[model samples]
Every structure is written in structure tokens, then in C-alpha cells.
Target: MDTVRETTSAIKLLEQENIPYTLHSYPTENGPVAAVDVAAYFGYAPERLFKTLVTSDHKGGYYVFCLPAEKRMDLKKAASVVGVKNLQMLKPEIFEELTGYTHGGCSPFGLRTKLPIYVDHSANNWDAIYVSGGKVGYLVEVQPKVLENLVDAQYAEFTK
Candidate 1:
């Protein structure tokens, strides 16, 4: 099945930038599938699969954090790095409005409006990592530095 979002603008951005990525698809379900599930199903290392999380301040401003599947984001630490007093996961509606993509389909690659991106320091340690392909049950493999180089993502200590 084609789990990738057919109408996502992220795909076009990738094509325009000539960024190489491997598209992966698995069975889509209603519930959340952890990044480990993707790694196991695709025969890749769990450490190499990343999950994109949307977090925000009290205002409308938001940030995208790309981290490893097994590691939990340290919200407090992240907030400190971003120089905000508080931060929390963005609501689904807010996410849709900001990125023009559904919760499971959100990709840092293409957004309706460009927002600041923060990559967990750990991600840079790896040569390649797997991220969302703008849809549920789909993943894209790319070099870790691409987030910073291509997306202008900042490096931060987002993990506890």
C-alpha cells in the first residue's frame, strides 16, 4: 500500500532540492506506531530511525525536533535550549495549520511556512537516520546533517 501522502508539498521540496531519500511503506493503522516498529519492520537499526515532534510555546510559535526513536525528548531541556520558559507538544489543529500536514504525516522537509528546526545532538552522531516521509507508515532515510544543511536546523541538547 502507498502509505506516503500523495499531495504533500514535502515531496516536491525534496525533488527540487535533489535530496536523495529512500521511501519506505508499511501497513497503516489507527494507533501510533513507535519508531522502533518502523526500524524492526524495515530491518534497520532502531537507533537510526528518527521521529519528528512538534512542540510549541504558549504563543503560536513552534519548533520541530528530530530525535531518535528510543530516546524521549527532554521538554525542559529543549525549552531551555530554545530560550523559552515553557514548551509542550503542539495540538493537532495547530500542527495542521503550521505545517499543512496531519500529525502522522508531518515532515520537516516541507512546510507551509518555514519554522525554526532543532535537531537533537544525537542525530548528528549518525551517518544516516530515518524520518517521516510526510505520512503514516512511511519513512525516509537521509544523512543526519541534511536537516541542518538543507533545512537550516540548529543543533541542540534535546535529550535528557
Candidate 2:
């Protein structure tokens, strides 16, 4: 369905930016939906569906990474990409307070705080990609260029 499951700051920001997008809502009755399942529902390769991951540098600074849902983040590469000696996933409990979004529901847009966002370079292989609609069970599909432009995200190779 093209209907948004709900309006979020992320969606609002897209509307404000005039970026074209489509919304897809997946069933969440079974709790958080796996990224693969979401991709399968739309008959897309996992690489086309990116998941937002949050990390913290040893120095307490936070960063966001977006990679294919099925791929793994190489800590060394991730740390280097973010210019950190040590990179750790932010604890699930801290996601909401720190980013104004819950675990598995954070998007690169409309964050509570400004954070450097890095998206996997693989995203460019797709004409468009899906990201959390700022909430679980909802996704927004938009051109990767537009997504990167709107969020000021850097494209990098951080996947293993």
C-alpha cells in the first residue's frame, strides 16, 4: 500500500523537501519484522533494503550507518569510516532517548540530534531503496541520490 502507516517527522521532512517516495507497511503482529522478510514481501533482494544501525565511538560521539539488512558491518571498516579507534553498537535501550526512535525503527531522517550518517555504497546500485519510516513495520522507498541528498549522508563501504 502506498499509504503511510503513520505520519512521522521523517515523512514530514520528505514532504517538505518535495522528495518523491512510496510507503509500504508490513505486518508487525509477530513483533519486529526481519529486514529479509520485508524485502521478501516486496520480492526485492536484501541488498536493496537497508537497515539503520547506530554506533558510538569510544569518545562518546554517536554515528549512524545504513547497510543492506542481510549484510554485516565490519567494525574495523566502520570505525575507520567514522574515524574512530573503537566503534560499538549503541545499546537498544538508548536508541529512543538518543535518537528519538526505537531500536529497529530509527531512520536516517529527523533524528533528535545531528549525527553523521554513512550509507553503504551498494545503495547506489539500486534505483531506489527502502528505509524505516521512522517506525517499525513501515518503510519509505525513495531514490538513493535523493535520500543521500536530504540527509547529507556519505556513501561508503562499511560492510563485511
Candidate 3:
């Protein structure tokens, strides 16, 4: 397959590792689309899509969470899992500053820094998951284990 820079760093890494993947992009309207929308348009199950969320511990430490699209992350539980006393989401500008990606384009694949990555245990239940390709209207489908392995993420109870 032809490699493209539109993908996240993680996707690039997958390419470098010779992992097979397929990239998908669609019409975007500059807003968060329901996971069901992606599934409906892409012809995949909603359960097979993950969303990348950028959050922080009150101490100014930012981290990323890759969770199933159907579930929401429990901030309290995430803070406890990461051993942080307080957890909150960073401001939109802060996220752009830290991750070098816009709100809708954030992908856990490659970031400006190696932020702690937490993948919900539910992700392991799926063989392939579709994640953002560092831009709105773009996504990449890859093996779930490959994503976790590339990011060196910890498996945790990240969803509500």
C-alpha cells in the first residue's frame, strides 16, 4: 500500500513495522461525529471504533486515552489508575500546544511527546479498531494489539 503522511505517528510506525492497515477518510464538518456515524459511513461496527481523548492530572501532566467509542472515560477512575490525585481535561489550546494536533485530529499514534497512553481493557476484545488518522474525516484501521504494543500503553478500566 502507498504510505501517506496524513496518518498519525502511530500509523506511520505501523507502516515502518510493515504492519498492514487501510486508511479511510470521509467528508468532515469540523465537529465531533458520533461513533455510530463513523461506523455507518465506514461500514464497520461502532464497537470497532475508538476515540482518542486528551486529559490531564491537575498537576499539569497530560495523558491520552484510547477508549471504545460507545463508552465514556471515568475521570475519577482514570486518575486512580494513573496514580494521580486529580484528573481534568486540558484546555483546547493546551491540547494543541502539547500534541501538535487540533481537537478533532488528535491521534494517539504519534504525539509531540510520549505521553502516558491508557487503552481501555475493552479494546483487547476487538481484533481491529479504527482510530483517527490525525485529522478529521480520516481514520485508519489496524490490529488492536499492534496499537497497544506500539504505544506501550497500559490496559486499564478506562470506560464508564
Provide the overall lDDT of each model, using Cα atoms, as 2-decimal numbers: 0.80, 0.87, 0.79
Better of 1 and 2 by lDDT: 2
Residue clash pairs of candidate 1 = none
Off by over 4 Å in 3: 1-10, 30-32
Between candidates 1 and 3, which one is better according to lDDT? 1
lDDT per residue for candidate 3 within 39-72, as digits (tens), equals 7777777778888898987677887888877788
Summed backbone clashes in each candidate are 0, 0, 2
Name the candidate that leads on lDDT. 2
Cα RMSD for candidate 2?
1.4
Candidate 1 local distance difference test against the native: 0.80
Q: Residues 45-111, candidate 1, lDDT per residue (tens digit)?
A: 7778888888999876788988778788899998898889899999876788888888876788887
Compute the lDDT for candidate 2: 0.87
Residue 89 lDDT in candidate 3: 77
lDDT of 2 by residue, 1-160 (tens): 6443588878888988888988887777884478888888778889999999999987889999999989999989999998879899998777899888888789898888889999999999999899988988888898999756888999999998
- Best candidate (score: TM-score): 2
